[model samples]
Target: MIAAGTASMGRAATPGPSRWPRAIVRLRLALRSSEAAARGGGGGRWAACFRPAPVAGAAAAAVKEAKGERSAEVEVEPARGGGEDVWSARADAEVAQGGGFPEHLVVMVNGLVGSADDWKFAAEQFVRRMPDKVIVHRSQCNSATQTFDGVDLMGERLANEVLSVVKQRSGVKKISFVAHSLGGLVARYAIGRLYEPNNRRASSAGKSRDDVEHLEGLIAGLEPMNFITFASPHLGSSGNKQARFLLLFYEHMTFKSLPFLCGLPFLERRASETAHLIVGRTGKHLFLTDNDDGRRPLLLRMVDDSGDLQFRSALRSFKRRVAYANANFDHMVGWRTSSIRRQHELPKHRLLVRDEKYPHIVYVEKEVTNNRDTEARADLYDPEEEMIRGLTQVPWERVDVSFQKSTQRLVAHNTIQVKSYWLNSDGADVINHMMDHFIV
Candidate 1:
């Protein structure tokens, strides 16, 4: 799942003298300086980095006005040979003057060990396909070595990155998230944080319930649109016996006891005691065994309703919630986990027949299990159903995509993104169709 690192965010303050030696701090600062120079000193702030011009003619004028710019009226050109541009059709519908076409911002988050660069092709395609209607931003704040941090910590950083962008762009009135693999969990936690009321005291103002509500309302006003993920272990890896075993192995080898003896020297950095620290914590969380605080699993807390009004409000505000799972060749995440469904709920087959309309995709509707049914099986706890019962109450549409071994050699975990060769071959259109639900 490791990909090239994109530009890093501003480094956090160095540890105190007791935590780090001056020599190491200096070396780290130098390395960061060179990395910034290579990335063209992009200022390490969350900004709208892509704004492709709208299609030629009247649409151009609309785009300018959409940006709050006044311009002379331009005659719209008729479709040549009575053919419309496929890409232009994907843009937002036109609006009358002063009606104001609210711009939608799509935030794409990469999985563990992945970077913003991984979304380069996907972002470009979205811009090229949707033009002025949508803007895509890739978050690389918690990638690479940084991914070794816990999900809650990463989620806090991502929340800041998103809030920074939202603060900078006043025109953006709606937001959507497209995350992959572990990024989905991070995004979930971040959104929960965003929904919560701001507790920081306002300058020259007293803290009150009204002020807190207003702060939360500001985020809610953004109009969360779509929450989508690809190959995300929503039910987590601990739901199954096999997955649990593998997670146990991974935890012991990386973070539990003998990570150094795992023979993965490349994962160790002198500045950071173990490069695997972040991954180990992440694994433990996913395995539902990282109860350091004596609380429930992180995933459970994420879906719980009591005392999480903000989280429930955020979840209810989203217009759509969807997940894409791989039917085969996805050894990292299983179908049930990625789909957030119970094993007994899905078909007993390895692969279903290809979908007719979306030949590359298979759609699975969530099985609604009645609470009474759960009462009879009290011995077993259905995490999937429990999540649905939570305040978030997500109604997920699980899509399963096929991966042919004869055509592709590697697993499908990483290929869910748009840039994958497998997706580019014939699956791009299908993926685009899936994304259409969020375009408007």
Candidate 2:
């Protein structure tokens, strides 16, 4: 029951040229030729080369040949006639229907050091529970490669990846994003890029305005559906007193090798550099500590009025936006940061009650204590303080879930998408609750 286009849970292929069969290569050439012909006034020459007149006995063989030697893991729709790719035709039909696209496209983004495989379990569950038409694509951003790069760079890459996905799945008019941890930030950054307004109204002679308009139309046409994050540090970890030490400890534990002075010497060096950058400028943005320039914190810039208006508009466009916070045993992102609320604002009491509406899930919601009501202490001027004020103004739902002590000990930050946890009763409940947000 794995969703369509879900990447294999094994290692990702190293970035390189894809080895293709002779027939497949020819097929691509034919497609390209057809596309070029379409752009010109001439009719498709390669179309006839690939697809000959249908003869009774040979038609079946032609169909088989067209199927090619594709792997079972990959789903490939047969090329339909009329010199147009099936996806393009489907997209055109969808546009004609005026209902936007009938199919739901869900993109699952993994956190730091996580590959597309991290979402395999969740994708399977989503496919099994959701409608058959839903297609889930697990995004591979800073997974196989270096994740130490800045969030902005990752965000730009993600934006390009998403655009590529959109182009490939032309019929996908609506999209829902499910991101984990740092992936949430990447997703946010991508959406911001997609929603950036065309400030330069007048297009240059070389760059036609129509091109810009078309690109803008394509982005706007993709109706953003649900946006859900698991254990994302929305409010950031910088403000959390415990986060600094935890991050350092986690880094040490991850990279420390007995043979080397600090573990793998090269890895340790990279980790040290990452830690410095993360705790300094990057950490400041994530934690809303220091505004590097006059600009506010990264999160505030993502959704504030003065920041990117189009980004804020795109965020508001989502039908449902939810952040699921781990109440216990999450060392990476704290519950307060995940919930985008202040640390002291959470309810002191821990009440575990099964939701009547969602029987499988147990959750707790705490009323937000407005920090703005309190007088601002006279302190050094920090632009982050202003950003935090703006962030608190924007209201969002936060659900708290706590796991059993044993589960907490075994499965902390990784509990969100791990297959074993999803199989467990409590984990199933959590998954059910998460899926509910995507419904409709």
Candidate 3:
């Protein structure tokens, strides 16, 4: 049944190449025009390139067939007040059935150069699967060239965007974040700024330990649930090394991968140095080259709570924290960085087996806590090692994904998140695995 379902999904999801070329051409033209407008100091022109369209619901179609009925129609609340474009996925069936709207808010964030449209498919899947359980909001505050701003500034915008959403959704009592790639880092920073201690719990002392724990902190004044990231560079991307030229050459020879990273070590070194010029401050942050105010890189400082930002504390408050990493063929992010592990800690090849239910998920590691003493500071120079040490202070569930055998392997970074249904439909299994294991 699982195998059949997989095949059916793949067939339904992958769009024919001949059918999408025109759309691609139009999109490219729109982006070029938007780029020109951006250069002319009009940032808002980029919005036209990402107008919300009906999400291609390949996974939702299968879900509807299984349930013997259509899921609730999703409603979109477009961008307003010059804020982020929000794809609000509300289940319409609940309203028809006289049910109150869902109180759990799921915020979906896009990666660098991406818009809220990037998360449309996943947002639709989430709403369709559990129409009454969640309200998925795809955030668009820092899309396009705006992502060129440093992580700190992007994070501030995200935090404010979230707050505005919460204000509008008065019934939402719980919150979760699902972010992709560089957006994961932005979400992490935003969470720190959004965290507020639950002072009401202090006044009520008779609560059980579990109750007290659950009420320990609030993110944007709502209980924090799951914090999940796909192919996120948690440990930064600079120092982490891949197999180099052999893999780079192989990817170029066979599949289309990111052009910025297709050379030898010297090129890799050069890319690290000049990344900021291409992608702006985000590139610096990803490469761990950002040093604002002569302090350590923002990622290193984020490992521990520095002053009011409570980065680590906000992270620990979540009920579950998950990092989904691509095991290979993800030229954009290295496995060591995404999974937040040391060089030797990566899973051995022998352990990677395809689960019948989740074909692409190769290995799952239970939460592991760092045993390093809290008093000890990480090595100052080795930021990657320092980040690993700092982030592992709290336990994290690591999920390793591999598209090595699939045609989509070359774009494993985007495939891991199923960024586009037509191009990365094979990753539907990965998205299914995430939703099936998602903590409500």
* 29-81: candidate 1 lDDT, tens digit per residue: 44354346436774232111111223577455544433334333211121222
**Which lDDT tens digits does candidate 2 get at residues 76-194?**
23222101111223333445777454367777887765666566556655654553446677776566333445466777777777777766667666677888877887787777676
RMSD in Å for model 3: 12.0
Which structure among the candidates has the greatest lDDT? 3
Q: How does residue 256 of candidate 3 score in lDDT? A: 27
Q: What clash pairs does model 3 have?
A: none
Question: Which candidate model has the greater lDDT, 1 or 3?
Answer: 3
RMSD of each: 14.3, 17.1, 12.0
Pairs in steric clash, model 1 = 148-278, 149-278
Model 2 misplacement above 4 A = 1-102, 196-220, 242-274, 277-300, 305-309, 350-374, 380-388, 392-394, 419-426
Candidates 1 and 2, the one with greater TM-score: 1
Query: Cα lDDT of all candidates, in order?
Result: 0.54, 0.52, 0.72
What does the lDDT read for residue 279 in candidate 1?
A: 48
